[model samples]
Target: MIGALLVMIWLLVAMLLLLRRSQAVEVVPSGSPDEAQIAHHLLLDASPTPLVLVSGTTVRTMNRASRLLFASDDRILPPPSSLFDESATHLRHAGRNWRADRVEVGDRSVVALIDIEAEERTAEARASAEMIQVLGHEMLNGLVPIVSLAECGVAAAEAREGDSALLGEILTTLARRAEGLRRFTEAYRELARLPPPLRLTVSIEEMIDDLARLFASRWPGVHLSIDVQPGLCGEIDRDQMNQAIWALLQNAAEAVEQGGVPSGRIDIRATAGDDVLIIEVADNGPGIPPDCAHTIFRPFYTSKAGGSGIGLSLARQVVQAHGGVLTLLEPFPTTFRAQLPGAAALYGTGSVF
Candidate 1:
């Protein structure tokens, strides 16, 4: 009877000890609610897209990017206007609606504004407006060409001289000029038709290798260096992402191709965090000009001479379409970083994206 009582007493003491340890646990284990929060810390810090958490009118949290975007938080917030705006500040855009509002949250300005359905809509409108202005430019490029040639051809025909030479020269020049227009229009089609990307579970390492191989093959003169993490891949479109990386590589190659810098170094890196992943491409070439830095991704903006200026913009579009982000960090040697959410978080968590 005493032994039995002692066993019961030991069991009771062990139960109390376990209860105390349970209370001391900081976060739930894997598959628990708190586990997800801990896993997403890096994403919360470095995500390129802005995120604002609100509970009825009280601002709960704003990430680093949201803070930088708003400029200042003290500015008054516009009243709620539309579901997209969620604010009442409606500035008449004449053709479209535009609004801006600011709120303060922990030393940051979170400006909540209208969420547009498409960037292509804006790009197409801008491209069309540019074409209207460039019509004269195109005419000038071609119109001056054939008059002299045609007149010479007629003179040759009257003199019983061979008209073939004059006619061929004029025809060749016209054909070349026409081909230029066709190529330009083709580029426009590529920009305007920014096709919907296919999303898949991609290992980040594989993309890095593929991009590296592509650049290595194309730019054999420039040295390519990749420091991507082997297992740190995420969900992204393989073809479009390959194209984006190719654009970045070309941009970097341009910066260094000239005779200024000794040996150009193109560094491609991928770092994966709990819930976020960042792929960075940095070049030791001449950094982007300060004047053109901010507008680099804007359509029709390019620092290069005779460059069509849509590559970076298209890259940005692709990243945005994947619910990811691409940004330029310009100081000395410029760094272009692409930030994307891990497939697991974006797919599993409701708040991800």
Candidate 2:
């Protein structure tokens, strides 16, 4: 919605500039062709959004912003259709998301590209600031007590007259708080330092089975089911993907356990379609709270007691590393989906289904 508004404002500005230029031409009557061309270029270049004028698939011209956007040694722009594929208003290129808007003008079209990724990053920075405040509060909650207890323990040791049991209790509490802080720091470190995926072809069914066994061992009371399309496979980092999927399963099992459902159940399904691998995990348990739907994936955010809150965040990071997305499907039996691209290459050749 914001991208559309920005595009509309820029287009209106361009049209108004053109209208004013036409009026100037009429008033002066002696404006040279070179002067008019320079004015046209200036009008397009003044806007920050990348704009490209194309005649069908051929690139007629583009401003400086567009040139920089589609930077190439030969200075040739890709076809507008290629950049903005049918039904795709969003394009991911050069590690950034662009909102593409194309407008037809006579025999040509003008494509406006807005950097929506910048807006997303701005919002994420805001959220991170808030998370940092919460983190500081949590750290201080643990640290203040630890410091006080350590001081008491030190005074007791120096005086040599303090009760032995009291000193032992103080030292024990200090060790526990320090261990908690260490684990807290370690979870954040894991979330921040996720390595690039080492892609390899693996049978989808086998992976799911392995995960099912692990889940069953961990949550014996929770019934787990797995369904994978026969002969389906994927080119992904096996260990990393397993960790990602296991986190999802763990979350579902924990939700079921917490909800105290009479018969807790988790169903995992995997399918390959349109060169993408889709994995969905659904659980029969209390669904996510409406308020938490937006922030569940944020690191260090959780409602559960003793929850480090890195499970979903780590899962998302792993999927993103494999050039995929992890999203929650709404309005039902609490489902999470992970879609990984390049599934066509991993189908049918290797059996073990």
TM-score for each candidate, following the candidate numbering: 0.59, 0.73
- On lDDT, the candidate that comes out on top is 2
After superposing candidate 1, which stretches have Cα over 4 Å from the reference? 1-163, 343-353
Measured on C-alpha atoms, candidate 1 has an lDDT of 0.68
Stretches of model 2 off by over 4 angstroms after superposition = 1-47, 51-98, 103-110, 116-131, 158-161, 345-353
> What lDDT would each prediction earn against the true structure?
0.68, 0.83
Candidate 2 C-alpha error for residue 116, in Å:
5.4
Q: Candidate 2 lDDT (Cα, whole model)?
A: 0.83
Model 1's TM-score against the true structure? 0.59
Model 2 residue 67 CA deviation in Å: 9.8
TM-score of 2: 0.73
Backbone clashes in model 2, listed as residue pairs:
none
lDDT of 1 by residue, 120-237 (tens): 5786788678756655565565556545555665675677656677667766766776676677677767877877877777766666777778788888879988886655556777
